[model samples]
Target: MSDPIETAIFEKLAKADPKSVGGKSIEPSDVAKELQPEQWQRMLPKVKAVALGLMRQGKLTITKKGKAVDPNSFKGVIRLRLPTEAETAAALAALPPVVEDDDDFA
Candidate 1:
């Protein structure tokens, strides 16, 4: 089964803009705080993990000091955002269409 907390993290990322008012990338803490005000600190680790997962899946990007970083290896502050439209289109093109198999019960 999928983790609901992880799902919530992804949903928050999906709704976040890639750039902020001053053109800064959105930090993982931003989402965490938005999801759980005073409890954001406890939520940080999980949020970062989910962001890394999304980065690996090409659904999001992670950066540090304005440069992209390896999500699995990065150990410091990082930012997360939905992929650009072009990246999103390319990722969609790379995926095979889902086809439900009706033979599961047979």
Candidate 2:
């Protein structure tokens, strides 16, 4: 099944997209706090992991200083936003194949 957490993160960012009548961007913590109010810190990493996965897929964008960045090699603060149609092509990055496993730490 598709991960609900990933779905929520994607949908939330979509709502903040200009094409969807939104002009603001969201932080990864916004999702963590919303979904795990009592223990958001634990959820933050998971949120980022899924967000990075989405970014790598070219289905999302992770911005730093209002500029698109390579998800595989970005540091410090980041904001989540949707990429423009023109950016979709350039946003796609070559990444190592994902090795599936049942381990939670994978």
Candidate 3:
């Protein structure tokens, strides 16, 4: 099971729309604040870590200055958003097709 805080971060990103930001993206701070206004700052690091993990899984995108960055190494300001439909399709297309092996018959 995933951490509740991490799950919340993913939920927020999934709900955001690019058109809402003039076709840009939403910031991590925005999700944190929405989840915990009183201690949003304290929760930021965890949220960012969760976002980065999601990016690595190809379910999220981290952008700096409107361009995607290495989620594991990015510094300074950044934004988080769900992969676009086309982006998702492209990623899925890039994956090796799954094949069942006889070992699974055990």
Candidate 4:
């Protein structure tokens, strides 16, 4: 079964909002605070996986000025920023058309 909390984090990322997933900006302290202690135990690895998607898309960056930064760190308010027209178009264009599969259940 998929972890609901992890799913929530991914859903937030797929919409381009990192802060919504219990993080401030990719800061460890912020994430630890935003997520509950129990959630945190399950959140770390999940966040790391989703963060990779963000990194691949160039929407998030990793830096090194002192201690290593957590990719899930976020800051400020949680806003769901919609994709721009061009981005939406590109994403839509990349998707395959839906196909019927009679051999399997819906």
What TM-score do all the candidates reach, one by one? 0.60, 0.76, 0.66, 0.34
Tens digits of lDDT, candidate 1, 1-106: 9765566655665565434222335777877887789999998888888777666666766778876676547888787655666655655665668998878775
All candidates' lDDT scores?
Answer: 0.68, 0.77, 0.72, 0.43
Sort all candidates by TM-score, best to worst: 2, 3, 1, 4
Clashes of 2: 0
lDDT of 1 at 55: 66
Query: In terms of TM-score, which candidate is strongest?
Result: 2
Among these predictions, the greatest lDDT belongs to 2
RMSD for all candidates, in order, please: 5.2, 7.3, 3.9, 9.5
Model 2 error, position 73 (Å): 1.3
Candidate 2 residues lying further than 4 Å off, grouped into runs, are: 21-23, 93-106
Error at 68, model 2, angstroms? 1.0
Q: lDDT tens string, model 3, 1-106?
A: 8777667766665566624332447788887887789999988888888877766666777888887786547899998766766655655665568997767655
| Alpha-carbon shift of residue 56 in model 1 (angstroms) | 0.8
Looking at model 3, report the run of 10 residues with the lowest lDDT sum: 15-24
Winner by TM-score between candidate 3 and candidate 1: 3
lDDT of 4: 0.43
Model 1 weakest lDDT span, ten residues long: 16-25
